[model samples]
Target: MFRVLVLILAFVANPSRAAAAPPDVDLELVLAVDTSGSIDIGEARVQRLGYLETLRHPDFINAVKSGYLGRIAIGYFEWGGKVNESSVVAWQVIEDAKDAEAFAAKLEARPIATRHGTSISSAIRFGTRLIETNAYFGARRILDLSGDGFNNTGLPIAVARNDALARGIVINGLVILIRPTVSTVPLERYYAECVIGGPGSFMIPVRNVEDFASAVRQKLLLEVGGLTPSLTAQPAAMHAPVDCRVGEKYPSFVEPAFRN
Candidate 1:
């Protein structure tokens, strides 16, 4: 009777300590997409549709099931100069096809809007915060960032990238090159040198709009399965290292209103 009273007292003193902890997930993935002025509505739509389809793909579903926990938590958000609350899709756990479809539907329903500036650093910082504060504990945390341009605003890309790496968060890149940018450095090289870091980190460049869907699906597969691509499939190494600050040197590229 005395031990029981002591236990009850402890529970009353620390209710949270007696409560169940957050669920464990195989991976915590934050999908940080660029909605800078450079991406027109059509291009944005393509990105949105590509992700929606990829989530429902059989290969991606299989990858999720192959995880040790058979589940992963994902959060989606669009970032430009800064992250807006309206652009964020709260974290969702995906363990099966139904969950994937529901999360994709939530993303598809959100209205797309492009904002000024290209701030990859802002996106990275925001993603890190989301991971740090999320309710699930994951075996691996990844920030999958997609962008058409470089980091022209906010903190330095290396700073944010390194900070995330220090927190054991892997950063991957999707370099969308369907449209041209003013920067002389190849976008892929820039991403390799500055934006992506941590173990198994890589960047995939989409040179054609037609390849966007496949590239996204392939990236999701590799990340979900925790596998790295072969050396031949990796981004080609450049003769000289890229200037990480090159984006800050050039003006932000804005798509013309008439262009699709």
Candidate 2:
């Protein structure tokens, strides 16, 4: 019995018996898609299809292949007022076309849903937690947040964004402009000033329905390659600064009549 106890103690103290280190990857990306009430079933379908196609595209595949580690870890989740476990797709490592296909298939199989509220802050917080807790160490951590409207619930946007940024997570935006909102502030301008940050951060505005897929594909390629678009291709500089707190200050702005 003494010998057995000694053996057990030795095993417990052994470094090798400790939890294994997470794998290293070129990037750890969380695709926080918006499924807020403003996004109708058709729009939700389009968003999902856009991501599915982008994941399988040659350009995105090539970008992943060219990474320093020749691999990336990606996760997908839908967000609105808040997040739930059911809406999150697990992380997957992509090193080749087959891996990418499998990841896309997982997202495709999940049912598209739209929850109430436009809580961009909550999405950012959730994305940060996912990256922090995932089983991979990435050279770069990014949260690619796509949304049609401003944040109307949860913590302040800047607070959540700053927290993520402090932890070295880059936030990029896919600003959907197809829906008209009560705010006169251009969604692109709002995202640029208040949403996106960190190295090589940028936002692409989808002004028309036809541009949705291409915008998503382009953003993914840039993110996978860790490259920022040229100055001319980025959103134009705003002559007037936008009030980042506009959404929170006017909760009524998220009402059905004002939503996209």
State how far residue 176 of model 2 sits from its true place (Å): 0.2
Worst 10 residues of 2 by lDDT: 251-260
TM-score on alpha carbons, each prediction: 0.84, 0.84
Q: After superposition, how far is residue 206 of candidate 1 from its true place, in Å?
A: 0.5
lDDT of each: 0.82, 0.82
Q: Which ten residues in a row have the lowest lDDT in candidate 1?
A: 251-260
What does candidate 2 score in Cα RMSD to the true structure?
A: 10.3
Shift of residue 34 alpha carbon in model 1, Å: 1.1
- The true-versus-predicted C-alpha distance at residue 202 of model 2, in Å, is 0.3
Per-residue lDDT over 40-142 for candidate 1, one digit per residue giving the tens place of the 0 to 100 score:
8888888888899999999999999997669999999998887866989999999999999999999989999999999898899889889878887666789
Candidate 1 root-mean-square deviation in Å: 9.8
